[model samples]
Target: MKESSATLRDLRPTQFAVGMIHVRRKMAETRAVCADSRYAFMEQRAIAVVRGPGGVLHVIDHHHWARAWIELGIERAPVQVKMDFRDLDDIDFLAAMMERGWVHPFNERGEKVDIGTLPPSIAQMPDDPYQSLAAFLRIARVFENPGEFNAKFAWADYLREHVSGDSGTIEGFAEMLATAFRFAHTPEARALPGYRPEAAR
Candidate 1:
């Protein structure tokens, strides 16, 4: 099968986390929240973004290309977003491969077989991997373990240390993009795309 277009590595830092939040919220709204849904999966794939010369982002189905669009009030509105998870098959295959390694292959007799090095059963990928990852990090914090999230932050800090003191517009712009995506446009808007109000009962 082809590669997934919504893998975690394909997502930017902010987009990665926000995507998890979005999926979680959507599951809740759609009344699809289940024991298995608690953990969202991030399929391996590519995501892209189309931007103009001025760094002004454009709208397109970059779901298979980039993490998410970070519209910084460019055109004529407060802010806009276009996130796409156009593929899921690749992710499933990779996840299965990660655990069993022989999800799809031919043997000497041309028969399907499980000869992967890893275990046979792969854990369900998290429905909201970012949120699940964050929660796990928090649990680590509570247990006095090394902070997984903070480690990433520290890495960023280290990178900044070697850079010049005068940060430019792109940095600020990216930060703004992250800030806007973190919060919901409105309370009603917080509902995920497929969420349903009647499911609460």
Candidate 2:
């Protein structure tokens, strides 16, 4: 319930993995969009965080942006507190976050992980290739809604089931993306977030 600016180093990530491709994309954008002044760019993008046990600020969104700032050696960004669960114990705090869709404690392979093992910071979060694919799918305007919390992660889970054999190369990602794009339009994907059934035709 508070909004303020905070140093990037202090913002803890709520997930164990991020689409590294997406992070790299943001990195490139940082140089292009905010090259003149990172601070000014940050002022325009305020990430959302929830106060957890011991008053830790857990990032709920814009995980890529936070990583970009730290990698670019930028110091801080504006953060808006969406909730305060500090009064709850560690277990209860995490439960609240998950219930509110504020935390996604899944790994690259779309496996559920203990929330306690969430990356200590955004910089340490590992890569989730399917996550990258899901993000690009969103950008392609291939679906609808796209508003629920962690919706992209939901797509990531779906992609993980339909696509496989990631070589972790750009070319490999392109191949996977092509396949995923097709699978995205199928009836099975209709249940996922941001599904525009008409887009299939």
Candidate 3:
């Protein structure tokens, strides 16, 4: 239950981008918050990690925050070890992680790729435009909070279908988001993550 300080370089991102825009915005916010003498950066801990084989600390969540910290030149941060899979065989460990929804094998293209294809560091994670769209949708309350494992991934996949490109400029993103917001309310989005029928809401 105790938190341990870890070098940001040593933590492995479990999934791909949560949205680079989200990471950049968080980096700015984190810097502002940490600038206040009354606020301690260490108090904002990255969530649980699993000590995988060969002593690699695999981050299960807070990927956006972690990426932001790295981009902000943060070398160390507090992390909690939720489980240690180092003792298990590699196959069993990976299986366990998948079973617990701790790993996402999808790439930025929204295609299910090999889990081995995952980036060894947060810096290498790709930018998925759908991730940005999903973040915007969440903020706009286009759908209720999914509360499901990898819910963002679900939203990302949904947004991917409506979006023509996998990447975009700031202006392009604004336009895409506006379109995504509209799409989220339609019957087409009913099967998406956290979709709530108008009557249900």
Local accuracy of candidate 2 as per-residue lDDT tens digits, 1-201: 566888899899988888888888888987887466865777667888888788888898889889877888878788989888889998888678778777776777678888777878888988888888888988887764456655787788999889976547778888899999989988889888778767777
Ranking by lDDT: 2, 3, 1
When 1 and 2 are scored with TM-score, the better candidate is 2
TM-scores of all predicted structures: 0.16, 0.90, 0.88
Clashes of each: 15, 1, 0
Candidate 3 pairs with clashing backbones: none
- All candidates: CA RMSD (Å): 21.6, 1.9, 2.5
lDDT tens digits, residue span 63-125, model 1: 211222111111111112232223435454345333532222322122344434221211111
lDDT tens readout by residue for model 3, 104-162: 88888888888888988987898887887787666666665554465678888987877
lDDT of 2 at 31: 83
All models: lDDT? 0.27, 0.82, 0.77
Lowest lDDT sum, 10 consecutive residues, model 3, at: 34-43
Q: Rank the candidates by TM-score, best first.
A: 2, 3, 1
